[model samples]
Target: MVSITFHGGVGEVGGNRILIEDGDVKLWLDFGRSFTAERRFYAGWLQPRGHSQLMDLLEFDLIPPLRGLYAQHHLEGSPIPYEEAHYDAVFISHAHADHVDYVRFLDSSIPIYCGSGTKLFLEASETVGHMDYGEHLYKTFRTGDRIRIGDVEVEPIHVDHSIPAAYGFIIHTSSGSIVYTGDLRRHGPKGEMTEEFLEAAAEAEPEALIIEGTKIDEEEGGLSEGEVYEGVLRVLREAEGKPVFYTQNRRDTDRFRTFYEAAKASGRRLVITTWTAHLLSKLVKDEHLDLPDPMRDEDIAVYFRRKRSGKYREQDYYHWERPYLERKVTAEEIRRRPGEYLVCLELHHFPELIDIKPRGGHYIYSMSEHMEEEALEEELMRNWLSHFSLRLHQLHASGHMGRRELLEAVELINPRRVYPIHTEHPELYRRLLRGRRVENPERGRSYHL
Candidate 1:
């Protein structure tokens, strides 16, 4: 008998952990943290203690208690005894925190598999933020690579998403094929990649389709990445003699490219922080991706803030940040020529506005609108922008498929049974895809195939 367990990503948006067991073969899909659960217990400075680690999280039932699945050190003081890895391997879908953050607690003996670009993302995150994902035997795979683990053979197909190197999986089991869509979007810049994945999934004729429904409730309209680019250009053109500041997910290279192009078209250099410059530098190594080299690109400039001792010193910043110091421009320089540059500033760095002080600039909010839980932060951000007399332009393309597109994709794939995860409105699928077998998975439940 073949069984699938929904450990996470049920009745929520993220924290996907799916266990597929066929006879003696067992493996997990994605081990991610639930944003909803994490916010409920921990907030701001009050976080889970490192020494107590698993104990703190397990106490709140934040992480599922799976024997022999976690590292011995993390399992210490817990009720479950330490044992050898009971699972075969972990197949990561991407490098998003909501999908791969929980991998830090897994046993190092179990191998972790992901795309080659995903490996680079993890390495960069560890180097800059000191966020350790523990020690694990890692294996990298690309599109069309079929990996065999015991009785199951897994094939990863590339999918378009907010982040690069996102993928969907096709698992060939003894019973039938199981398809897992790992945070895909069909309206982004690389929508063709998602089309390729859909074709492959349709050909496989999956018995079970595990898909994400992040925007399943929102029907009809949504902006594409191309539309977002046009919006950025419009904002830049209207800024006139004032500076333009934009904020987006730092990991979103596509959005960076959009702003880069828009800045160039507007005859302005795009100024980014040292951290973003470092990330772009690392990402440029991938020959397939067309990212501008921060070290060589004249259109790109690094923003260096006054560090320790109130001076711009190389030693003040981290080792990774020092590389971009040579191309640094201080706040005074930006203040002198505000209209000549488009600055990329994060919410935390809003204090820098006191120094750069533009008369009346434009602030492009190139990210998702604030969710209900983040209302206070949104209000504070608006207050800051208002204080500076900056015109706020909210232009963003969602990183998920719209309701109609998602329904169409499901119909094309034509899976025998559809289980919607990573969504709050799984029930919408029942109404949307009438006559199809739509299952709303419950957490910690085992469903046999």
Candidate 2:
């Protein structure tokens, strides 16, 4: 018997973790962390109340608490625990933060199986001083590459995602096969390659399809990153006032170009903070995407505004190197007039910047769903829109698959015992794939396979 358990991201889109066991052999699929949901419980010294569900997501294997591999001495607030349990191997699908952030949490000594690009990103994060993660124990493989683990043979099947070089894993045993779609979609520059991978898997015809439903509940299929570009434009075009594009910091260059085009069309200044500037710089370094018309320093504005209740505002324009980006401002910009700006919620200085009611300001919350969107009342999103009096909107697009496509994916893989890991709506997948024996392994519980 082969057993799979959901540690997190079941009935949720992120916190991707799963433990697979056969006989004495036990290993993991993806050990990931979900920041947005964790923030709900532990943000700003406020311990959230009424969390029956939060308790459930926290449970891991008979699951010991995330090990002390991550030294939490300097870590304050909720530093997610590194799951350092003993395992034969840990396989990674991609390098997206949600799927990969927990690397710092895990014991650094374990070997991780991933592609070149994935390892490149994991190393880059460590090299750039983003996190103090230990060196990775990585075995690189191309698509169709297979690695042997005791009695199990794990094959890598490439999948197309916004990010380059992602894949699904095909865990093979003599009795059956388990194909795990490690956080994938049907769209990308590599979509054709992904389709080929799916075709190959169809040929093999796995017994258990341990797939992901990152966006399985949606009516129309999830929007492509390109569609998100169109939606962001629509919000900016239809809005009555200066548009405020609110979103998370994913390394999405396509979305960045979309913002740039919208800013140019609206004839408003394209303003971004220091972080976005750095991200853009990195994009230029790697991929040759089209860039926006450069803005002068005087045209760019930083939102970390200062409170005028007897205070001197210090400017932090450190490492902001844009040859074309001209209009840059610090906390002092608060006294100036209103202009089209790009600012995150944290930078807006609370009600001082937001509560000053304005009719034309369009607020687009491109918030990606986690455990919170369904469980919590939109949390920070609701608070900011209500506080600012700005016309609230959702120009966001998901990074996951929709319901119909997810079913189609299950059909394509043709697994015997289907296990849904990446969806909070695992029951949805359970119902959709009727013929297969679907299992939602109870976290913290042990099963003999």
* Leading candidate by lDDT: 1
* Residue-wise C-alpha lDDT for candidate 1, range 233-302, written one tens digit per residue: 9988899779899988878888999999999999999999877887888888888777999999999999
lDDT (Cα atoms) of all candidates against the true structure:
0.89, 0.59
Off by over 4 Å in 1: 370-376
RMSD after CA superposition, every candidate: 1.4, 6.3
Candidate 2, 1-449: lDDT as tens digits: 77666676666566677777877666778767665556555555454333222233333221225444333321223335434445677888877766766665455566778876676566555534355445567888887678988898898877876565578888876556777788766654345666776777777788767677767777545566667677767776676345364654345444555566665666555556545554444444333244432343333343433334324233322334433224444333422433455444432334545434443466666545452323334666566666655666665445456787778876876766677766667787667777777777555454333
Q: What is the C-alpha local distance difference test score of candidate 2?
A: 0.59
